[model samples]
Target: MQTNVYNIAFAESTKQVYLHFWGCNIKCKGCVCQKVVYDFMLDRNMHLHLAEPRGLAAAPERFMAFNDVIDTLVGLEAKWVLFEGQEASLDPQMPFIAEALHRHLGTTNVLLTNAFVMPDLRHFDKVAVGLKAFNENLHREYTGESNRTILENFPRIFHSGVPMMAETVLIPGYIDYQEIEQIAKFIASVDKNIRYQIDAYFKAGNNPWRRPTADEVDRAVEAASKHLNNVYAYKGSEPREFGVKSIFPTEAELDAAELAPAVESRHLVYA
Candidate 1:
């Protein structure tokens, strides 16, 4: 009776395989994968919601059994099966899911999450905690929830003795120079077992906002440099990697047209 919510991915960039869980604890507003969980609003036009899995389509089934999910991975015969995406800890399913995949495939499990909910430490090998922002207001404004939950849970999340990769997405104007400085110092104050990741934002996905200037991203990076070690920006996404897809007509695209973005139009159709 394990949850059948996670997926196996083969990344073209790194030739790496990933096992990501669906659903999330915090709703980083305008998120792309709207079909996956309840934290954010869904955009049906851009992303589809199917009743079952068929190829790369997003499946509607929220829970995936570990044994059956493992069968998918072993069949693919991938090198490293990373436990990634959405938020892996929304249910007790992850620890058991991780255990099943690791025991059978003997592949590495890497988690990329907001750290709002920490999994049992004994489950995985490596962890990547999306350390959203150092300040509470900015974090909530950007991701739609206070940083308090994450701040409280992060310490115990690392009890696994596994190295953690700390990530921070630098959105335009949201994460200012002062905030970046605070973020760096905060990361440094926490156990130094973490690596700092500064990622950039774009008009795509579920992200809705103005694009920050290149200079601003640079300044934030500079401010962060003073407080911690090993900082790097998440390279911007390609304009439209066809297979990469879009959730809604991007904000810029929405403004450019006199018409409604697909989300509104589609809702009108079925309403």
Candidate 2:
């Protein structure tokens, strides 16, 4: 049970986990995955490509034997393992990694994939696919390709009996009601039970998308509400921003007192 070294997704509030593998097919234009790009550039001994592929560099650095990885998970007593990545299904070793982790953690396994590769769910406990931008052309424009595979794999995996969810980057103008509706339709086709999430893309540091507005987010959520039973908007601050307390709840605790429920405030605009 060998495992590949990867950056753990250290969300301020979430479950204990590790991003198992590396490399991605999509070089999203405004990617938050810049670390992988930098790592790939360093690993391949290549320079930065801020061009079409944007920050997508390939550095397939693997580490930690499978057994060792399992031992570590057991040692940490991590009840759950999340196989996360730009598109984890693209990693061939995913099934093996999942199997090994399943045996040890016996925890719910969640995969965050763009669905670049059709996954073999024989080992997965839960799967989350990025529906990305709602608009087909818009999605391709940002992520470098159309989400045909992700779209195609929807019902296939849903019917496979794994707990699944569909998510999107709520980029207004990029992801409008039409787009959200399309995403909802796709998820409903798979399983009406699958949850949906809209991650608000705000400017991070000096990153270009740092200040995406809340109106657009509202539109996306409004649209998705028609189709998805559950939806959460990421990046919007709780209480202060008037967002749901459980909007982006911590993995360990569903109800953390610090993150109070929002009061439904005004949509924020980026400067």
TM-scores for the candidates: 0.71, 0.70
Per-residue accuracy of model 2 over 179-200 as CA lDDT, tens digit each: 7778887787666668888876
Model 2's alpha-carbon lDDT is 0.58
> Local distance difference test, per candidate?
0.58, 0.58
Clash totals for all models, in order? 8, 8
- Angstrom error at residue 94, model 1: 1.3
TM for candidate 1 is 0.71
Q: Root-mean-square deviation of each candidate, in angstroms? A: 8.5, 11.7
Candidate 1 overall lDDT versus native: 0.58
How does residue 85 of candidate 1 score in lDDT? Answer: 58
Number of clashes found in candidate 1 = 8
- Poorest 10 consecutive residues by lDDT, candidate 2: 241-250
lDDT of 1 by residue, 143-203 (tens): 8889987877676666557778777766666665677678778777776436777766544
Candidate 2's C-alpha runs over 4 A off are 1-3, 9-15, 35-62, 204-210, 239-271
